[model samples]
Target: MDDGGMPWATARAVGDRGEDLVCTYLEGLGWAVLDRNWRCPDGELDVVARDGEQLVFCEVKTRRSTRFGEPVEAVGRDKAHRLRRLAWAWLEAHGQRGAAFRIDVVGLLSPPDGPPRLTHLQAVA
Candidate 1:
């Protein structure tokens, strides 16, 4: 919602909605969502979830269209590196010591007038 007075209402709305969708879906898959839109010095992680034995840190990318590329392809090397660092911060802050963790990417392709397509990529780091 904070766009620094430069309103990107549609984008923000879509992003928020997509994140909610991801959370719901992940919960159904038995993952406990710990945080949404977590911001650290390294970067922001879209979702921090726990899937049983592993702490799953997720990066979510949603797009109205795949004209440019698939949503999953958006997380490049720099972003991946930042996510790794953020995961470290998350682990340390939660007093969650020495659990196996992995990076996951959830891509939501929400084309207008259709259901959103979600693809989960595991261990994307």
Candidate 2:
């Protein structure tokens, strides 16, 4: 893991870059990338994608290692609530209120080839 930026700053950078890799991964799996960093009062979602008729709200967590637990597990109840609200805002603003949607998590382990993973949990929060 790089240490150029402050702890949080570096981590955010890793996650931001990692989100791009995750988006590419998803796109390869037939998911179409949509809005990225869609922010509202309920925090910010890293990426949004479309799989057929379902909209996917993605949360990206990047870490040097999994010493504590899986990166996606970091998304707790509070964050989930905010993401849900943000999703709602996204829906209303995009005039997609009636469309189907779901939530997903992208776990990115830094250092490029260090076992980056994706755990997609549908319909969260």
Candidate 3:
């Protein structure tokens, strides 16, 4: 994590930084972020938020660079499917039903010496 703008070492740090940035961005857009790193038997969801009347399950992928590809490209069909399942699990655990939900992806590129980039994809599933 970056404390006082100091970067940390490790992939987890990058992810945490990306999530923090995304949360701020979403909040700026009037979305109320609810759960972060929500986990179930299925897997972990990076973020969950309410965009007005809709529930958004967001998966965040972050990288130092795009040498391989954009971070959002890492999420394939399998991952999307799992996110859907996880969304259901979250709803079931919370005893909520008939709620409108959507899957979203937030791709981040945070270089060591420059401003970070963020891409928000809606309805990924």
Q: In model 2, where do residues sit more than 4 Å from their true spots?
A: 1-6, 111-115
Pairs of residues clashing in candidate 1? none
Q: Write the per-residue lDDT of candidate 1 for residues 1-125, one digit (tens) a residue.
A: 22224358887888788899999999999999999998877678899999997899999988877775778888899889888888988888888767689999999988778999999999989
Model 3 agreement with the true structure over 1-125: per-residue lDDT tens digits: 23234455676777888999999999999999999999887789899999999999999988887776888988999999999999999988878766899999999988899999888899999
Runs in model 3 deviating more than 4 A are: 1-9
Candidate lDDT values, in order: 0.87, 0.77, 0.88
Looking at model 2, which ten-residue stretch has the lowest summed lDDT?
1-10
Error of 3 at 38 (Å): 0.6
| TM-scores for candidates 1 onward, in order | 0.89, 0.82, 0.91
What does candidate 2's lDDT look like per residue over 36-112, in tens digits?
A: 98877656778889999889998877666666576777889988887878888899989999677887777766655
In order of listing, the candidates' clash counts read 0, 0, 0
| C-alpha RMSD between model 2 and the true structure | 3.1
Please give the TM-score that candidate 2 achieves against the real structure. 0.82
Compared to the true structure, candidate 1 yields what TM-score?
A: 0.89
Better model by TM-score, 1 or 3?
3
